[model samples]
Target: MDDGSGIAPPHIEGYEILEELGQGGMAEVYLAEQKGFGRTVALKVVRLSKYTQVDQKELCLRFEREAKIVGKFHHPNIVTVYDVGTMGNFLYMSMELLKGGELTTKIKSGRVSALEACNIVRSMCEALSAVHAKKLIHRDIKPHNILFRDDATPVLTDFGIARSVMNSGDATGLEDIPDLTEVSMIIGSKRYMSPEQSIAAPLDYRSDIFSLGVVFQEMLTGERPVNFHDPASVSNPSNNTVAWPQEALIFKPLVTKMVEMNKENRYQSIDDVIEAMDTLDNKFVNESAPLRISRIYLFIPLLFLISVAIWILSPFTTNYELTALDPNNRLIDKSSLSIYLVEGLEKIRSFKSLPVGEHKIALKVSGYRTKVIAIDFPLERNTTINLTPVSSPSVEEFYTFQDLLEKGPANSASAKEFTERYGGSVLSDLVDIWSGENAVLLNELSVAAKLNDPSAQLALSELYDRGWYVPKNSDLAQNLSKAAAEQGYAFAQFQYALILMSQMKYTKDEEEFIRLLEQAAEQDFFLAELLLGMIYANREYRSYDPEQAHRYLRRAANKGDRVALYELAQMIEEENPEEAKIYRERAIRLGFKVNQDF
Candidate 1:
C-alpha cells in the first residue's frame, strides 16, 4: 500500500485505487472505487513479487481458496466478497466497504458495556458459526478482523489466513504441498491465539472460540487478558489463564470457561456459547462496558417515549447461572447441559422469556445427576444449584425411598433431587427445634443418610455433636462425618478433620485427620485452605512447611478468605511492607476489618 500520493496503482483491472487503507500480514487493503459499478469496495491485494515463482503459485492457491471459502458465506454479519481478480503483480479481492471502520477502533478508545459487548460477541459467534459450518477455520479472530457498518452492526471480515482446504479432503494428490504452518513459526496474533494455536498445534473451531474469548474480554475490560507482556512466554503460556476484573464477577465463570487452556474444556460450539450467554444476566454486560456519551445522546433525542418503548420491547425474562458441582465442590465442565419447561417441551433450547412465577424446571448434567425443582424465580436471580454426582453404590444403582435408608451414600443425585422436592415443607414444619421431634423428620434423614447424603449426615452429626436431638454421642458424630468425608463431601471432610484433630477426645488417628484436611483443601474449601495454611505456617504445629503454607494461604486469599489474606499480610509484613499493605487492602475490601494500628 502506498502511503504518499496514492500512486501504487491508478487502476487495478478497471477498479481505481482511491486510497490505501492499511497493510496486513500478506496483503494491502485499499479503498477502491469501482469504475463500472460506480461504488466503493474494500480491495485486498497480496503482492506476489516478493516470493519466488513456486511460492507465488502456492500463495495464489491460498488467495483463491480464501475467495472461494468467503464466497460461500451469505450471512448478514459477514463482510460479503464482491469480486476477485489478478492485477499485474498482485492477486486482489474486493469486499464490502464498511465506512464505520473496524471494531478495534472503538475498543481502542474505551471498553463497551457488557450488553453491547454481548451483542457484538453474539454477532461474531453467528458469523463464525457460518464459517465453521463449511468445515473451515478462521485461524485469526482479533478485534481488528471485525468491522462495523454505518449503524454500528458488527461485521466479521478478513478470512485470508484461514486453514488450508483441498478441493475434497485430497491427501495423496496434495503430498507435494508445502506445510503452511511450521512448529518454529507461530501463526495468528499472539494476544488472541488459543492455547493450541499458541503451541502451533492442529486446531479446530474451538481455537476460534478461545480467540473470540480474548476479544470479548478486551471489549469488557479495555485491555487484553494477558498477565505479562513477554511474547516468548506468551507463545508457550506458562499460566495464560485470564483473571476477570472484580467488576466482572457475574460473567467470570462463562468467560473463564471460554478461555480454558485445554481445548476439550472450551464450549463445544457456537450453539453452546449462545446458550451460556442466554443464561447470563445482561446487566453485567451493560455495566462491563457502557454505551458511549454520543450513543446516549442519540437515544436522548428520542425522549421518554423511546425509553418506555425500549423497556417494553425488551424481553421480560430472568437470567440464571445454572452451575453444576461435584460432591468435592469442584465445578463440572461441559456437562450434558439441558433445561426443560414443565408440561410444554422436553428441551427448551432458547428462552425468550421465563415469567415471574413458580416454574417447574428440570435440569440434567451428564455423568453426574438429574435434578428437577420448582423455582419462584426472578427473585432467585443468578441461581447456582449444586447437584451431586452418581458415585459407586454396593447394593443397587437406583435406590427407592426405603432402599435409600440402607444404602451407603444417600448423597446420590436422585436422593438429593428427592430431598430438594420435600425438604422445604418438611423443614418448614420443624422451624423450632423444640417442635421438630417427628417420625417423618427422623425417617427422611435416615433415608438420606443411608444414601450417604452429606448434608443429611452433616445435619445428624451436628445434632449428635451438640446433643441437640440425639444423645450428644461424640462417637456417632465422628463416625457419621467420616462417612461423608470418605465419599468426597468437602464441607464434611473439613468438619470431620476438626473433630479428629481436637485433643478433647481424639476418636480418630492424627494421620487420618491430616489426610482429611488435605482432601478438603485440595477441593478449595475456604476454611480447609485457611486451616491448612495456619497449621503449616506455625512451627509448633505437627508438620510445618513455609512453602506449602504460603501456597495454601495464597489459594485461600485468592478465594476471598479475609482471614487467610490477613494472615498472608502479617507473614510478609517484615519482608515487604508495600506488598503486605496491598494484601491488607485487598483483605479490607473483602470485609476483613483490619486493625487501625497497622
Candidate 2:
C-alpha cells in the first residue's frame, strides 16, 4: 500500500499498511490496521542495513529483547507494545496508535500550560518508575518519544532504545557495531543524554533520571537546557565542556537538582524526585489558598528568641549589615532606622525578622570591591543590614528593602537608566536588574508601585510572593499581592484570593476569604471565578445555586478554561439543552473530552 509520503511502504505480517507515519534514524513507523481486529496500530519497521549476518541475528535477538522488556510494562502512562515479529528481511514491532501529537509539538506551539506540564512530568515519572522497577532503563527520553493520546494523556513510547539492566551482553554487542552506519556510540539523544551515558560509561537508573530532567526542563522552559549537536557529529564534542544552563526558566528547585551533572548528587531514585516534585507542587497550591498573617506572625517572636539563644551558644560567629546610604536619599520613612549594626561579633548572632541569614559575606567577583564595617550595638535596637554589590563601582550606594517599601513616586536615575538599557518588559530586564542589586530593583519597584505602574507592581509582588531573591515572608507576600491586585493585576488577584482562602480555612476567617474571591473574580481572573462557581455549585461549600454557578462558569469557559468546560458540561447535562450544547461544543473544540468514560 502507498503511504502518505508516496513511498512504497514495506508490508509486514498480519498488518495491512494504510499510510506512512514517519521515519526516524533506524526505524520507519506506519499507520496500519490489524487484519482481524480492525484496530489501528503503529507498526515500526527496524532497518538492518548496517548489520552483518552475525550482527543481524544479534540485532533480531536484541529487538525481541526490547519487545519483551516493553511488553512487561503495562501502565496507563506508558505506550503498550502489542506484538513483535519479523517479515521477510525486516524486523517489525506493533503498538497502540496515539492520535494526539508528540509532547515536543505541544511545547513548541506553547500550548502546554504550566499545570499541564506538571501533569505530564508527573505521569512520565510514574511510567519511569514502573519501567525502572523491571530493571529497564529508557536510554532515550526526549520529547519526540513521548506520545499524547486523544485525550491529551501522555504516554512514553519507543523503548527500542532502552537498555536492559539484567543482561550485560547487550552492551558488548552494541559497542561492537561499526560507527559508519550505526547509531552513535552515545545511545541516546545528545541534548538529553546523562553525563555517564555521553561518555559510554556503565549506566544505572540515575542515567534515565538525568534524561527525564532534560525533558522536564524542555517542557517547562520551551528550550533545551543543553544544546545538542547534529545527530551525525553528536559524539565529537567533549562531554566536560557541556554544562546545563543555570537560567531559572522553570523556577522550580526540585527539578533543578535532578539535572545535576554528578550522578551521586542527582536524585537517588525516581521516587525521591517524584516526592520532591509533589512537595513543591503542593506547597505552591497551598500558598495559593487563603491565609491569615496576623496569627502566623504571632509565633515569629518566639522562634526568633529560640534562634538567638542558639546563635549565642555557637562557637563561630560573624555578622554585619550596611549602616549608611549615599547620595542623600529622601525615600526613607520617618519611623525607619538607618543605623544597622551587628551585636556579638565574637559570638553567635542572628538577624531578626530576616529570611535565613548567613555569616561572613564576601564579594569576590571582578569589578566589585568589598567593604567591611564593624559596629557595637544593643541587641534589641540594632538593624542588621545586608550590603548588595552595585553594577557601577563609581556610584557607592546602600539601599534596603525597607527603603524600597517607603520610596515615594519618583523613579531613581539608576532605575530609569537600567530600564532604558534593558527594555521596559519586566521579564526581559529581570536578569540584569537582579544581578546588579536586588535591593535597588525592589526600591525601584516600590517607586513604580506608588506611581501606579501596574507592571512594576505585578513584578514586585511576584518576587516577594515567590521569594525570588530575598527570604520568603508570607506576610510580605500577602501585602504585595494585595497591592498588585488593587492595581488590577489578574494573576496577582488570583494569588491574593487563593492566599485569603487558605487563611480563612486555617483561621475560620470566612468573611475575608469571600471578600477577596469576589474582588478577584470581578477583576476577571478566570481561575478565581471558576473557584467561586464551584463554591456555589457544590452544596458542601455554599448554597447550590445553579444559575449563579452557571453564570460565572460560562463566563470563564468562554474565556477558554478546560476545567470550567468540563464542569459546565456536567452542570448542564440534562438541565439546559441549548446552553449544554454551547458548552459541550466549546469544550470539545478546546480539546477537552465531553465524556471521560471512554
Candidate 3:
C-alpha cells in the first residue's frame, strides 16, 4: 500500500534538499543548502502527493497562515522565518537552521542546572511578552517545539495552532476541512497543553504560561509532571504530580500555580510569571547599581555607621509602614489580613519592630487569594498585587468565563470534560442550575449576577423583563444585556439586540441595533442569524437586501435551525418550487410548524 523509500525532491526554489531530518503529521523537515549563500537551512514542506487537490490548497493556506504569523516576529530566541512559497507541488518554508537540535534531546540527557533552567524560562517569558503584546497566543509550546543552537539558546518554533487574539483575520483555512467540528477540537502537543486548552477553552497569554510551566518542570526534573499525555489526563488536575528534588523546593510553589487548573488562579500574565521567577531566585533581577572599589569601601564604612545608628535608634524608629492592598488597590484593613515575615514564617498582622533590609513576606487573608511579595524596608512605594476574591469571581473574570463558556469549547466531547474545574468554585451551585445539575436559590442567583456572572446576568435580565426576581424594568434588562454583549458573550448580544428591536418605538438608535444584531450573527448565533435575516428581508429598520437575508438564513439553516429552514423555503418557493418543497419537508421533520398568522 505504501513505498518505504522517501520521495525527496532534488531542489525547491533553488534550495537543494540535502537530507531528511524527520517527518510530522502535517509536514516534513529537511536539511537544505541554499543556492545563493550556500547556507544551510531547515526547510519544512508538505508534499503534494500526501493530499488531494482540494486538501493541498487548504493545507497550503494553513501553512501560509503560519508563515504570515511568524513573519511578524523577530527575536533571537524565536525561530527566524526566511521565505514562504510553493515549489512544484510542495508548500514549503525555510527557517534558520539549528545545529544543536531540540530541547527535548538535552532534557533527556540529564537535568539542567536550576539557574540554567530559570534563565531559559526567562527567555521564554520575554518571548511570550512579545507574542502577547502582538495579541497572539502560541498554542503549541513544548520542549519539542523549542530548539537549540550551538550556544544552547532556546528558539521557539511551530506556529501551526497559534491564534491571534485580535480575531481580525480571515479563517486559517480550518473552515475548509471536511469535518468542521474538528476545528473546535484540541490542536496542540498534548503533553504541554494548558488546562484551559485541554478542554478546548478559549485561551489568552496565560495559556502559554501554563505550557511553559510544563516545559520548565521537565527541564528541572527530567520528566513531565503528568507524563501520560491524553485529553483526559491533561485536563485532570489530580494527575499533576511535582517530583521535585530538595534543590527545586524553592520553585515548587511557582511551578504548581503556573499549571493551575483554572486560568484565573494562574499567574495572570507574562509579567506575573517573570515576577514569580525573580521571587524564586534572588539572582534574577531588574534592579541593581554599579559599585566601584572606592564606593564599596565607602559604603562599608557608611553601612557600619548606619548599622550602629540603627541598633541604637531601631527601638523607637519605624522600620517600614506596610499596607495591604485589595486587587483594586483599595487599602485593606489590617485586621482581615495576616502578613508573614518571610516564606514559611509565622503570620503576624501587626509588627512592632522589623529589620532595616530587604524582606520577603506572604500575605494571606481569610477570603482572598494569598501571595508572597518581596519587600524592602522603608519602601512606601505603591506596588500592586493581585487579589482574587475567595467567595465570588470578579467582574472581569466572570465575564471572561462567560466568554469561555459561550465560545471557548462547545463540542460534545468538550462538554464531558472534567467539570470539577468550574464546579469547585463558590458559584458551583449557580453553575449547577445552568447545567440542570442542581437548583440555585433566588438570592444566590441575584448575588452571582451582581458579582458579574454572565448566566446570572441573563437570568436577572429575563426576570427584570417579566417582573419576577425584583421588578419589571425593560430599561434595566437592556443595560444588563449590553454589558454582557460588550464582554463578547454571543447570547447576551443576541438578547440585547432583540430587546432593543422590540423597543424601537421607545428607542431611536436603529443603526446601533442593526449593528448589534450583525455582531451576534458574526459569532454564528443561530437565533441572531435567523432574526437578522428576517429583519433584512424588509426595509423596516434600514435599507434591506434580499441577498444578504438569504446568506444569513442559509447560515442558520446549516446549523440545523428549523425556523431558518422554513423561512428559506418560503424565500425560494417562487423561483425553485421543487427545492422549496424539499426544504419544507426537512423543516417539518425538524418540527417546524408552518403558520400563516404572524
Two-way TM-score contest, 1 vs 2, winner: 1
What's the count of clashing pairs in each model shown?
14, 13, 0
Off by over 4 Å in 3: 1-5, 166-183, 226-241, 283-598
Residue 77, candidate 1: C-alpha displacement in angstroms: 1.3
* C-alpha positional error of residue 3 in candidate 1 after TM-score superposition, expressed in Å: 16
Off by over 4 Å in 1: 1-7, 164-185, 227-247, 281-598
RMSD of every candidate to native, in Å, equals 26.2, 24.3, 20.5
Task: Report the C-alpha displacement of residue 384, candidate 2, in angstroms.
Answer: 52
Q: Of 2 and 3, which scores higher on lDDT?
A: 3
TM-score for candidate 3, residues paired by index: 0.45
Task: Give the candidate order by descending TM-score.
Answer: 1, 3, 2
Off by over 4 Å in 2: 1-7, 47-55, 166-185, 226-251, 288-598
Candidate 1 worst ten-residue window by lDDT: 392-401
Which of the two candidates, 1 or 3, achieves a greater TM-score against the reference? 1
